[model samples]
Target: MAYVLTGCVAVIGSNSLGLGPIAPEVARSLGSTVPTVMMAAAAFGLGTAASALFLARHIDRIGSRRMLQIALALLAAALVLSALSPMVSVLIVSQLIAGIASGIALPAIYSSAAAIAPSGRESRTIGVVLTGWTLSMVVGVALSAVLADFVHWRAVFAAIAILALAAIAMLSISKYREVLATESAPLPLEALQIKGIKPLLIACGAFMAAFYGIYGYLGDYLHHGLGQPVSANGLAALVYGLGFGAATLLDNVVDRLGARRVMPAAFLATGVVYVSMALFGGSFTMLLIAVFLWGLANHFGLNVLIMRLSAIDPARRGTIMGLNSAVTYLAGFVGTAAFAPLHTEFGFAVSTFVAAGLMVVAVLAAASRPTEAIVHTVQSERQLQ
Candidate 1:
């Protein structure tokens, strides 16, 4: 189950991060500008948000396994379309389709992870699954850079398609088929009204906006602001991904320190790193270090958030997770779309600080009473155990 969940998430990561490293090159090839090409990211996020809002409710009714299979098929088709796209519009549409697939797939995977997780080890199980996303940062973003530099950007999508197909094959095995037979309760609309959910959703939105705003443009920033070669984009992403992957090992730390204490700290630390990037990004070493720290803090905070949300309502885990995904991706869309203009008009420093400010807001929001509620909830669950 863990392996299957990881494989599914890896496809999501590839589809999400695949275009970042090659945005500039794709723009050049399509006779467009970098900011224009970046719209694909926004489109993808919008699609994901839409799917999470409208389609995710059906996951519990249809069963996670079936939903995952449908999502994988969508992803495969989207990748092929992306590879074959002749115009920027077509590429944007392809990305949108891929994003919708991811939105549908990821929440199902998360719900499955929660359902099958061993008692007292739920966070660890979810963390292990999320590591697939971090690995995607390496394999998807980093490798895309190398491939884009050597072969062509189109090859990146083709590679992702193959991986998606592999994941489908893995799911087709008899063991997974048996797992998919289990049915979950339908998602309740009242899940939205659960205590602490609203604030957490707000925090997630702010955090994603801040994080993706910088990340969506990191490649162009390195090329334009630091005057680095195209290859540096992938190398920097690799370093950041390594940090993210490494941080997953510390999921146990969240259990020890408690999420209430850790989440605000991570948000604060990530904010500082974002500001540092703004101040010292001209130095390649400093930029790399800041990016690494950003990934580390961001992923830690995200893990805690996921664990908390998953624990909120076991019966509605799918719904809560899906809504969480929707909020995050909507923020991603806004951030990516907003950053392009901010960076274009005021340059990297201003844009970076804008992101940092959003992180600060997220920190404040997360540190509020909702966090206390989460801490109490976790403590109550542990006492029951």
Candidate 2:
């Protein structure tokens, strides 16, 4: 079950990240500029953000497994269209459709991970599933680039489509039953009214924005500033991915500790990572070390965030996770756009500090208790006394 979920996530992750390395080839093939061809990626992100906001509530009503299968079908169609795109506009439309599928698919995957976990091992299970991102980052993405070079850029999308088909088959045969909603589920926007939800969502937004803000310029810093080759950047990506996967080994520890108890430390450690990167980004070796640590700290933080969001309310998990993912990708765009000026006027160092400042906000958001949770706890304590 975990393997199937992991495979599903791997396909989604590849759908997002695999386009970057081969954008040039895609541009040349379609007779468009690289930046123009990359509009497809942007369209996909927007499609995801919009779907997450509007379509996420339907996941519970439709059932996670069923919704996932349907979304994968949509993704397969989109990827097929992408493989056959004769122009950049067609590619953009195709990716938009793919993004729409991802918005639904990711929340379903998260909800499924929670549903399939043993009693106390939900966090660990989700952590294990999150490692699929590492698979995409370190393996699928690189392989796509290689295939684009040796075979054709279109083959990359076709390969992912095949993987999506495989995931659908695996999910169909999986025997677990989800507690699906009937026609009378809560309203779509009501998930935000749940206790402790607002703060968690705020933290998620801050964390995502901060990470992307600095990371958007990381390659440029390495290449133009440090004079490193393209291969070194790839090595940096690999090291970061390995670090991310390595941190999942300690997910059991997190499960034991409880996500709420560990939230502050995770965000703080991530803040420190940003500061260290700002301080040590000059040398290639030091930068790689910092990047690795960044990934390690980031994985724990992200893991706890997702775990908390998933556990908020089982019935509302789909909506809650949709909100989480909505902020995440939207913040990705915001971070990149907001940091561009700083990265242009200054070097990457200044933007790193700005990113760290956002982490401070994340720490505060995570540490502050929602009014309802605290009030309920206090009232319960008084009654006990």
Candidate 3:
């Protein structure tokens, strides 16, 4: 069951993060510019954000298992469509379809992790699940560049489609049920009213904006700007993913220290990394080293965000996490669109300046301390889990 959920996250992450490493190749294949090809990626982000906002609450009504099955089916179909797309417009539509599936699929994954988790072990369980990000970065993003270089860019999508299908089969025979909603489960927007949720969502948005703003052009900068082969980008992702996976070892520490206490430092580290990236991006070796640190810091940021949000409203976890994904993917769209001009004209460094600033916002948001009463309440709820 853990593997199935992990697989689902990997598949979704591939469709989202994997696009970055292969964007240059896809651009060439479709006779388009990198930014133009990225419009399809933006469309995917937009589609998922909208679907999660509107339909994520439904996961509370239906079992997570059932919701996942439906979503996997749609994702497989969308990947197949993407592999066969003849042009950017067609690719955009296919990706949007995949995004719609992901909107439901991701929240289901998170909700399931929390449901089956043993008390006091929830953070470790979630950290283990969050390793799916590393899997996507390594297997999805890293390998996609290699596959796109050696084979066709379309083959990458075809391969991810196969993984999605396998996950569906794994899910079908399992007697699975992980429903995180109760009678009081909030609607999508209502999840916002929960104490501290608004700030968390804002932090989520700013963090994602920073990542997407720089990452959307990372491959282009490495490939076109530096005259590196596509495989070089794969190597970068592999290094980053390793660092990301390694950070899971520290989740228990966060569990011990408390998420709020750790988040400010994590975001600050991320800001420093972004600053390093902006200053040293022209050096591929330095960039790879920087991204390794980038992954390390980001893993903590993502982990605690989930830890805080999930603890805040267990009854409405589906809705809360749905809003998390919605904000995250929407930020991806906004980041990509907002950074396009700077990336196109001035190269990657200029965009990193803004990305670094956004991290400051995340740092500020995370630093807002909870009242002692509220902290006591949060701690008590966590103990109950």
Measured by lDDT, the strongest candidate is 2
Extract clashing residue pairs from model 1.
Answer: none
| Candidate-wise lDDT, in order | 0.82, 0.89, 0.84
Candidate 3 lDDT over residue span 1-385, tens digit each: 7667887899899888777668888999889888778777777888889878878777776777788889989999999999999998888899999999999899888888877767777667788888998898787776787899999999989998999999989999877756444474456666666777887888999999998888767877899988899778677778888988899888888877888898888888988998898788888899999999988998898888888877776767777788999999889878978998989988787788888899899989887755753787789999999
Q: Model 2, residue 241: what's the lDDT?
A: 95
List where candidate 2 sits over 4 angstroms from the true fold. 183-188, 378-385
Separate clash counts for every candidate: 0, 0, 0
By the TM-score metric, which is better: model 1 or model 3? 3
Better candidate by lDDT, 2 or 3: 2
For each candidate in turn, the TM-score is: 0.85, 0.97, 0.86
The TM-score-based order of candidates, best leading, equals 2, 3, 1
Best by TM-score: 2
Candidate 3 overall lDDT versus native: 0.84
lDDT of 2: 0.89
